[model samples]
Target: MASILITGGAGFIGTNFVRHWRRAHPNDEILVLDALTYAGNAANLDGLDQVRLVVGDIGDTELVRQILRNHDISTVVHFAAESHVDRSISGPAAFIETNVVGTHSLLMAAKAEWLDRGSGRPHRFHHVSTDEVYGSLGPDDPAFSETTTYSPNSPYSASKAGSDHLVRAYHHTYGLDTTISNCSNNYGPYQYPEKLIPLFLLNCLRGIALPIYGDGMNVRDWLHVDDHCQGIEKVIANGRSGEVYNIGGGQELTNIAVIDAICTALDRAFVDTPSLAQRFPAAPAANGQPSASLKSYVTDRQGHDRRYAINASKISNELGYAPRRDFAAGFAETLAWYLENGDWWSALLDKAQR
Candidate 1:
């Protein structure tokens, strides 16, 4: 069985992938390395069997080297990074240090262990990235393909783009077996509340105003975390070396559309429980309405991309990777998960406040 090192395994997509990988390959050993930043929650990975967690910075070369050599890790799924765009705009240094420097450190360590120290066995280093690296698109522009020119708009996307280049450099310069997947926006369980979906969901539950930035016309391709993980698995298993794949859910929706969807789901959820409205008395109202009426317009984020859509045909045709989750159905299920697991997300918010 192969030992796989999943960096940032405690974060949203990383945690989902760990759970997915555990079920799909029960015998394969998994090692998680996370620094447990504000976005990382250990509880997201709780109750899983046979997976080891190592809390540490990915930039620590010695620590990364030890883990690679000691664990006999043959696969590295690099996910650790400061990924929030707003945060990156307010403070780009953390993004550079973690996304760029940390990725470089991990790449060097992996190269040392897999290529220099041991016999050159076939190993994999899969870099998980975002479609924002391709920059914004106009209304009539085609979806971003693997060949899309890199024009990262925000600092977070720029940092990720830098890391993507590093991975490519390692593959070409040193023959390190590597692959990359640039996915669209991911929304599902265990996602940090700062993101749009979960953030609006929590606001709807707590009876607070769902703040929509600017006119809320910015568009994003939403991919469920589970579907994204499946694509990652397919890429790792069958993807050609030194290749890049685009993974998308094929569901494009504006930010306002996403919020409206969540509001509708919340209305259904609270249909029978009128008393729930009593709990969140402070929920703002618009034009004398209630709940979803609480949607308030806010200033737009700086450097916000106008639109991001992914053309996943490369992965679909080459590796037979297709997203299995339908947006409406999967989104409802995701809302249900948050509704049932209130304590899980509540505890995370509590910790963040502390």
Candidate 2:
């Protein structure tokens, strides 16, 4: 049984990963370190009993070092990142502070803790990153392979790129058994409402306009949260040190397509249900309008990438990682989760808006 330390274990993807790992490895002792920032909700871990949650920042070097030493953590899963691109646009400083500096501090703390524990005990530091570090992909360009050069276009991605570099440096310089996995867009239950899927879902439910940036053709590879968690577990268990893996479900879909799919799902879900039908009526006809009626075009975001796709062949071939949930099934489950668990996201939205 391994003793693991996970940073940002209260955030969206991080929380999901912690829950997944606890269930998968029942004997493992899991310690979650979170800053309890605006985005990090302790409520995400309300019913989870196996995880030992500590409210702290990854940037807190002394705190992190203490946690590492006290927990006897053999693995460090770094998932604490300021990841929202729009938020990064509005405020880039937080991104740099939390993503770059915070990661560096955590790595140093973990390195010191590892040394104190004696080099004989096996230790691994796994960094979870996003595919946006590769920049935009053209229509015909190949998917982002593990070898793709880092061309971060947004502040968020740039900060993450910096963190990724730090992780690599630690592995090469200190031989701190480490691995990095870059993943595509993830959508599933417990996701904060700031992202596309939950944002659109909540907007649709609230009778608010669904904002589509530009022509709404920006493409993204959607991976289920469970699949991403599985990929991380695979890397932690079997990944090579100083290596990078790309994890993706390969569910390539355009932005407009995603909005349409969600609406269609809601429409179907509403049908044959009086309460839901009362909540959301059928959309009006086009009325000779050239643009789609369901989505309203909004100002394009700063430094928005037109496309992001990952070549997940490396992980699939090397670690036998395969995404079990297709978009349809996965999306259905995600939508149902939001519909069923309104209180969780409602409280999150309230806090974010505040």
Candidate 3:
């Protein structure tokens, strides 16, 4: 059994991956290192045994080195980053510090433990990245492939691109066994509500306006967090070193289309179950009104990409990776999770206010 270090293991996609990894490989030791920032929560990782969480930043190279040495960690799954585009625009420095500098620190420690120590032990460093690094695509442009050129538009994407380059550099210059996977947008349970889907879902329950940026025609490929984790597992288990793979859900839709889908789901739930009306009394559907009424157009995000789609054929052909969840079933399950676990997300809202 291998001991693995999971950076940002308490965040949305990271937490889901931790849960997924545990189930798939029960004997592996998991060391989770996280800064517990606004987006990362300890509760997200609650109820897992044989998993130790260290509250710290990845920028602390020494801390990571010790974890690698002490735990005998053979794999590092990097998921930490300042990922929100709006936050990055308002404060780009933090993005650079965390996404770029922090990633470098992790690479440094991985190199030290596996290479500098002269142990030359088998190690894998898998960097998780976003497809935004490829920049905006025209509505009819082909999906982003592994060979897509880097043309980041936003601060967040730029920082991630920088980190991606660092990972590739480390592999070529230092011979560190590293792989990278760029994935599409992910949504599932335990996701921080600041993201579009969960945030809008919460608003639907509270009778608040669903804010749609600009014309809301922006297109994105939506990947279920579980499917993304499965793709990552394939990459870790069978991917070639120094190669990049793209993971996608095969579901592309406009921003307005997504909101409309959510509205339709909520309306159905309220109709099928009367108790939902009592639980979420403020919901438009609960009060005999259409949920679509809550949609409100707002200012567009600066440098927002018009479209992003991933050509996942590389991973699919190489490692037999394919997303299993269809958008309708996946979304219905997501809505059910949010509806049943109001307390989970409510706590986040309450704390954010404080």
Per-model TM against the reference:
0.96, 0.95, 0.99
lDDT for each of the candidates? 0.91, 0.87, 0.95
Looking at model 3, the pairs that clash are none
lDDT of 3 by residue, 1-354 (tens): 889999999999999999999999999999999999999999988899789999999999999999999989999999999899999999999999999999999999999999999997899999999999999999899999999999999999999999999999999999999999999999999999999999999999899999999999999999999999999999999999999999999999999999999988889989999999999899999899999999999999999899999999999999999899988878988999999889989999999999
Cα RMSD for candidates in order: 1.9, 2.8, 0.7
lDDT of 1 by residue, 150-261 (tens): 9999999999999999999999999999999999999998999999999998887666788889999999999999999999999999999999999999999999999988
Q: lDDT of candidate 2?
A: 0.87
Please give the TM-score that candidate 2 achieves against the real structure: 0.95
lDDT at 233, model 3: 95
The candidate 1 region of ten consecutive residues with least summed lDDT is 280-289
Task: Give the C-alpha lDDT of model 3.
Answer: 0.95
Give the per-residue lDDT digits (tens) of candidate 2, residues 285-353.
112221134578889987789999999999999999999999999999998898788778778777767
